[model samples]
Target chain A: MITGMDRLAAAIQGKKSDRIPVFCNLIDQGAKELGMPLKEYYSNGENVAEAQLKMRERFGYDNVWSLFYVGKEAELLGCKELIYAKDGPPNVADFVIKTHDDIHRLEVPDDISAHPAFQETLKCLRILKSEVGGKQAICAYVTASMTLPALLMGMDRWMELFMLGPASVRDELLEKCSDFFRKEITAYRNAGADVCVYANAFGSTDFVPMRLFRELSLPQMEKDLKPVGIDGVVYYCGGARMNAVLEQVIDRLGIGAYYLSPLDNISEGKKIIGNRALTCGVINDIMLIGWTMQEVRDEVRRMLDAGMPGGKFLFGTLVMPYNIPEENIRAMLETAYEYGACVEEATS
Target chain B: MLEDVITAYNEAVFDTDRERALKVIHDAVDRGVSPEDVVFKVVIPAIEQMIKSISESFDANLAQHFMTSQIAAEVTEEMLARFRKAPEVVGHIVIGTAQGDLHSLGKRIVIGCLKSLMIDVTDLGVNVPPEKFVDEAVARNAQVIGISAMMVHTARGENGCIMVRELLRKRGLEDRIKIIVGGAPYRYDLELYKTVGADASADDGITAGRVIAGLIKEVRR
Candidate 1:
């Protein structure tokens, strides 16, 4: 019997694993169900380690990330943070480093490890690596440069600039953000992250046009992520098709995975880039949003049936489902454990 | 530039040289083009086309919604700049994004379209405290107060209007300043606009402009 981590490693490495890898992200609710507070888990290394173990044991998923989000980053970055009580994601206070002139004020850290968020991610990754090392893959969660800068600039005003900034202004800001992420990725890898997952929130055209999208964002991965051998995964919540043009992206960088996104033409996406690197994710939202236990099993089974035909599959959402029902989450974990293993090739 | 702008706008649905597209309107207005005709035939249908596109899974890398918004803002600002130099348009409207919300794209779009048509617009940027909305409405003597919400969670912030009405304690003035609401989230529940104490709401800029134009005409009469 293969362990979950070993199975996931086999899958990413394109080898025969016992089962498919279950690598879904976690939210605070799942942690509290096991007696960990969201805030404490973030700051206290012991609490974070406990929560990571609980997530692994309960869900039986393959990878446990160093759970770093923008909130802690915001708090650590001298931004006002609104702490929520038992509900909602904690929010950053209203302060922005808006405009091109403000860009000059943007500080790229010296040695980068000095940032609290970076420190926390490193500490959490060390614990996860110690606990899950060689057993399952450990991911260091990182935001895309375009997104981190936008948040730091204040989400509202940054959004306004998307409509206002010229190609040059947008590129400049994205580059700064990219620079920040790249610096952090190297830092994250040093702290024990096997792969740094890049979460780019705004590449969706539901809000931005493609021209600026390409100019401002497309080349960021390679320029920023390549130096550390850091494998990149672009994860956005609602699917956006612009991501499919990996020819330009992958040519410049090492893109290891694409999270489950409806925007990508999964079949075509697999055909285009799956042969080049590890291709994972295609779990549907309906399965996790409001489906029954059997229905959830059937959904994962369906993805396994449909998406796994060519190989290199990782099981999960495109964007991690925040505040998902724990029952459904556990049901998903069970489904992955029960059915996600690899088999002999027809005994040829 | 025009060709790329059109392709980007048409392809993404949200892409348009709002400045150039609205130029057609401003030019028409400059040469005595009927505001109603320019709006109904040109701007209305075009933006409606865009509204349809955004409604159909628009993306920044794949679709051009935000840039379209930028164009809209520039066109609106240009028109407003031009309009300030001209004769009074005899209309005043206040606009804002609801509280606990900072998205200004949709509001900026609506404000831009109104400004291009030579209407007066006072934009209260995102996460506006309700008192400020009411305060701005009273101070501007706005004929209509417009509110926009883009996300489902942010729609909860529309509770600011009820706060405004209650804080003012005058349904007459509150009613006089007709509250208008619009955005992606509001599309599902038209009554949400009403529930938030808005007198009217439209899902897109065209209908919203038309609604405001009519409201202003009525107030002027």
Candidate 2:
């Protein structure tokens, strides 16, 4: 039988796996669960990587995200100038885009050797690729480009553009952001990441409306995803009701997996995407934030039952937080190990 | 006529295509829509639609998320500019980034929603100390102050509370205005806000808007 790691790499690449993969979004529980100090992990990349390696070795989960989240991408962009936050990733300097003119003047960054966080991300991936990527799979993380301009340009006047100008102009901004991510994704894959994770932490269920989904996000995702080819996980924020949108994304673009938090009605999603895409994540983050080991085990059991009847189902928490307790994480991994053992797929 | 405008506005807003929205607003106005009708009927509904879209569909892509939002903000300002009548109550609210937090998305959404309510909003942008919010409230004689933080760690936000206390101590204007907080980090409850000694806390803009309106009314009464 193929090992869980081999299975995950296969399923992610649309190949066959031995059994289901025990997915662990360790980035969520890195600070607390792994016993790494958040301040130190944020300050020093080597410490952060060491901490991540510790969690992977300790938990023995199938995967590990290179860093806390995609703040590194924002750091790569020139928008994060006032970054004195050495304790963590550099944050957007100030949300003052100054004027509409600032939007046009801003250029999406692409030079990776010069991008500090991108370089750090690549370095970590390189080390991991040598250490673990072949053993399992390594997901290289990048943030959405348009998200930053809004962060940098300020949301207020940027919104006004929809009312004030031609749609083509806004389209231009979306295009530039897409180009930056595509380039970065290529760089990461070339550097030896097994998969690339398209992460947008701000994309929540109640966050943005639907039409923008079709025009702006979907198009950009489709465009960049084509180059990413087969091995990419579309890690989106949750809006469980937007099943139609999710189905459309998988149908329009050949996404390898969908990593979401709330699985409010995942059975329905399983039917919607069929075997075309793998399903990842459903355990609620709040449960792990304060639950005991037993409680965490129960939640994992519940999600595995609800989400993993079929072969392509990977086990993950609802969402990972950087501050969840270690015992909770231990429970989560142990539960997956116990229940995920050689399950027969209900799939015919 | 207003109903028709609202329907069209709501339908088109989700697309995040401001051009279609511009056409809808102009059409509503050409039909002799009042500025109030245009804003409340045509613009706000579209804004709400766009907001819903951002939350659901386009959210995974932060670039689209911000692009759609920026378009929403520019649209709000443009629509308001067309209104010549003295706004019924050009209510003023001072908004800012909480101390030690620099995220600007939630705060911008709040300001946009308030402006659609025809309330004049004063956004201090990001990373402003809590003192700045209070000072702006005092100078503008602003009726309300809004602070937002997306960071989870409480220590940073505790600094924001200190800024508020310092503001009151220096200006003696503690009773003159109400303070509100919102953002992703505000998970536990409104008590976190109360614990911060804020008048209220909310995660989303609509709730914040309704609560602000209610608080303003109570203060006036």
The best candidate in terms of DockQ: 1
List model 1 lDDT by residue over A1-348, tens digit each.
Answer: 577666655666677667777777664544475565656545565566667777677766767767555555444444655534233344454454755777666666666688765666667777877887777667766777667764677654666555545657666777776776777777767777665667665544333455545665655645656655545354443343434455555565556666646545566666666655655656654236456778878876766665566667767654334444677777777776677666322110
Model 1 agreement with the true structure over B99-175: per-residue lDDT tens digits = 76655656765775676455788988877877888888889888887877654434534356667656556645744
TM-score (chain B) for candidate 2 is: 0.78
Summing lDDT over every window of 10 consecutive residues in candidate 1 chain A, give the lowest-scoring window: A339-348
Docking class of 2: incorrect
lDDT of 1 at A157: 60
Which 10-residue span in candidate 1 chain B carries the lowest summed lDDT? B58-67
Could you tell me the TM-score of chain A in candidate 2?
0.83
Docking class of 1: acceptable
lDDT of each: 0.60, 0.62
Q: Candidate 2, residues A98-120: lDDT per residue as tens digits? A: 65465576666666655665666
